[model samples]
Target: MKIPNNLRLIVNMRFYLTLCSALFLVNCSSKTDHIEMVYGQTGTSLFQLKNKQLAYTVKKEGQMVLDTSLLGVTIDGKNLGSNSKISFLNQDKVTLKYALNGIKKMADYKGNIHSYEITEADGFKWKLEFQLSNDGVAYRYKVPGSGSRTVLGEATTFKLPESTRVWYFERDSDWKLKSHAGEWLSADISEMPTVSKMGPVQGLTLTCELPMGGYALLAEAALYNYSGMRLKAIGNNSFKANFTEGDQGFVVDGTITTPWRCILLADDLNALANNTMVASLNPAPNSELFADTSWIKPGKSVWHWWSGKYVDFREEQDMVDDALALDFEYNMVDDGWEAWEDKWKKIAELCSYAQDKGVGIFVWKHSKEINFPENDYTIMGHFLDSVKQAGAVGVKVDFMNGQDKYIIDFDEALLRKAAERKLMVNFHGCQQSSGEYRTYPNEVTREGIRGLEVNHMQEGPLTASHNAALPFTRYVTGHGDYTPLGFTEPGETSWAHQLGTLIAFYSPFNCIAENTQFLLNNEAIAPALNFIKSVPTVWDETYVLPQSKIGELAAIARKKDDDWYLGILSSGSSKEMTIDLNFLKDGEYSAEILADDIEAQPINLEGLNKEANLRQWNTAIPFKKLTEMVSVEGKVTIQLAANGGAAIRFIRSKVEVK
Candidate 1:
């Protein structure tokens, strides 16, 4: 039941707590100054708001996980939750359809919801809504009043047990407002305040191990029109929400609704890897805007930029021809294409040529050229129109580096513009994901994780441990365009290991960055070509093996239709891992494996970047092959070299004839 604004506050607090807890079926909480708010059940989890205080506490399974922390937002230099009155508004159920353009077995979102009202001292009002589910708790602030408001910042904070361990990324020096495209780091929650000794510890997407029973992945969701939020260490085991522009702040016009502050609670790492809480907070696509999803079928692509970024009209046609041979859906023309003498005319000719062979062209556009606000959006509109007119299926928007409210707004506007032109989107040089894809189906993939392209170009080699950490850390938020499989450079891992990345990382518009001529004709890769050719870019289901650990090893199985694809990545040292086929159907099935050859000496290929040498290559580290018939109770075992990986495929067999 909702408390009316005119309802008088009870003069006696002790009596009010008792009345609300014992006699009334109210949305209010349990006895005395300590009020239990989130879904008032006896056990499990509860978000408590202490009476006579504006702070909040969190408990799980009757164990304290978080101590009292501040709860309020500072708007125009006014503290909204201070000297204010709060009343429980109402309770309802959270229900959402399982709709997505592509990704794992589409997850469902259902929970119990409760609302509270916070009326400031001057009578200004806003709403706080919390949704509690078995997966976790998500809450957000919604201001009912309209008009432009400069948000100073939020007072929300998280105080955890000192013993909690955290896995996160330090903020990149260039991008102070965001925490993405950086090396992964770890520290105890207690050590966070002093982490400047290690590096900056401000902008973080943290996955923390609670001292009690479960894990909490602290992140934000539905980041459409607000300054992006990151956590700043505040001494001890506490963190305060830091806005994108720091003190200067950003303006939110019209209705002010912030993204959901989420804690994805899970019992094990597997559940954590598969958490859908981020997507749960965002609304589904507008039915009228996205009535036809037939244009959204996802598939693999052949990319020219990932291979090197040097593009010309003639070279692009070769990419399209290679895509046709591989039966791929799209051919990406990355940066440097615009430098062509007649870029548009050539792009149109290439798109026309690829269209006849069942291939679509995805052109690249720099955000600096079209995404700014001065030109009245005409530049962006014209670019989208030109691509659609050229028969291109998608646009890759690059160099969107900030997360302040203005940049966030521009990102959404670009998606809307591309959607109207029926063009898919791949956001590169962008901020980390907050499950915005649930609302924008045209967004096929995005770059938030430090992916393969960076690794190939950087001075150092990509460590397998970083690759191993992705499944649990980065991928949990949403799809990562990790443009996997860069074969030209090799400093770590065997050739087969690079092939395995094609299955490990989750990117709907999967782009292969290897030398195309080498990938097609290298006799050494012939045995594994079939598996690579048919790998599923979008999955029906995913299972993280129980043996998996962050930054050490990642063994996962994904299902598409009747076949199962397994990707295993191991780091630090050569080790043996096992796969139990317990999830397979009852009948026998055929399995084909492409794995690291532990004993073979890797062949030296210093000239892989040279076209003359690439075509002449016929030898490399042997990809150990295995074929067997297995059942639900059977197991398949493989050994991995240091920084090694493998890809396996399984197909169920038919019943035998009598």
Candidate 2:
């Protein structure tokens, strides 16, 4: 979609996009035991072969962002690239461009790519490839031999420089965990506490403040047809890849290609938030299967499962009505819908009813019901066909709790089959999808973050620290199905905080998990409800505020059309934030700021605050609202209470000719 001549918004985002479009010259040099590549105006990567071991260093612009890091992967119990004769194969200059309906709308890639072949002592050889782009650099390995083989492990280690601070936590600390969700813990790499040797590190993303300068985020990308790769603290101020499925290793048939280990380098928070490296590394959506992506709609949905209500036909019908009233795009019928007598017919009736009302329905399914130990696309296809017949626009497949090869294959089959049926999907209780949405746009979101559901299961409200952590750590990889709002039970966060997440978090299907009946009846919230209704689930662009810090603050502005929604979140104490309106076009905007009302005492809702009661706080929401005129150069001051939030909608005001 091209921008209108009148709405020239990109001009206002000069500072936010300075680093994104710098023209650079590609340069490369190769020696007997040294290979150096530089992506001019972006970054440089240098590889060294010392004592027959291969190690590499990365730089952002001219400064060193990564110290030398050892690289290798073990195949059939033999070390390759760790201590082997690796010779350069070839190098190439490449360019890529694509568009997305979620996150950043479009991405253009101009970078340098190269490959090297390493010969094992026994004469076995494999190719190691690396690619560099504006946002980051990535490396992967490709095995050559055909037929089945059992690969053991990887020696791929990230040797962090001394004195760099890290924010990471041990994932899967409990061995029996089907877990990928975890909050970040901060410390120096040496002081990094809780290094669980038994657990797998999944997006432990602590934006490491490199000693030399800039920030580097170590992450994995394009995780397909392979058991997932996670990191573990190796205790030498380094992190190494660990496949948690087992030490025996994933059995592979024919030549196997490993996923890319990406090091996302950035100078500031905005660049980090806007980095498209992960999605860029993944393959584009299969154009053959989805010849027309018009059916793929990204918008807000009305969900009541988090409300913990029995969604009978009447109740779901009420919810659909609520969706219509709220101008929501979807209405979801969660788990246990199949238990209904004559389930398919009843569901189909409900779907028909919803369709007539101009609303779509989403149904849930257990993975085991459709995916057997043996690959069964036919069963999955049948289920998908039934849902499409029943009027479901999407499917929420629940309990997809592993990252093994079986899980990988099952997901691939389901996505292809679901797309063929024109039904979208969300993998509930699933591990981190690692940007699979780029490959299958119908895979809108997955449950990997310790979000709203877990937020409800715990004692008291979900901590603001946990809420603040997402944008930097978890969200950088891909969207998580947080189901981020609940008014009837605001938990510990303010009503405004619940509202802010709709913009701060990036999920194509922003399924708000709240009882809409309450929001409708409460006249107190009507003033600020328009923002909720107008916020888009996907954004054209996003700019993270300089005030933002992981686990401390989350302030961001997202653009769609001519409007920009700025969401502010603060952890721990109250804060006063002054947002520079430099990102706005040169025009007056009716800025609606929704903030916490400290003076509005809880009218009999204190008990719900102490112990979350899913029903009461709906009517007792005490939120404050203000509207004023502002412009491109103006600044807006927002006062947030302890563990509170604020949201502002910048709607361009029409200027009349006098």
- On the 0 to 100 scale, the lDDT of residue 424 in model 2 is 89
Give the poorly placed runs of model 2, Cα more than 4 Å off: 1-32, 41-51, 169-177, 193-206, 373-376, 603-621, 656-658
lDDT of 1 at 170: 48
- In model 1, residue pairs whose N, Cα or C atoms come closer than 3 Å (at least 3 residues apart or on different chains), thus clashing, are none
Error of 2 at 444 (Å): 1.4
Q: Please give the distance, in angstroms, between residue 586's alpha carbon in candidate 2 and its true position after superposition.
A: 1.1
Range of the 10 consecutive residues with the lowest summed lDDT in candidate 2 = 22-31
- Stretches of candidate 1 above 4 Å error? 1-18, 22-32, 38-53, 101-103, 175-179, 196-200, 374-376, 610-622, 656-658
Model 1 lDDT, residue 27, Cα? 33
The positional error of residue 48 in candidate 1, measured at the CA in angstroms, is 8.7
RMSD each, Å: 5.6, 9.0
Give the per-residue lDDT digits (tens) of candidate 1, residues 359-447: 98999988889976666588899888888987899999888787888778889989888877778999988877898888887888998
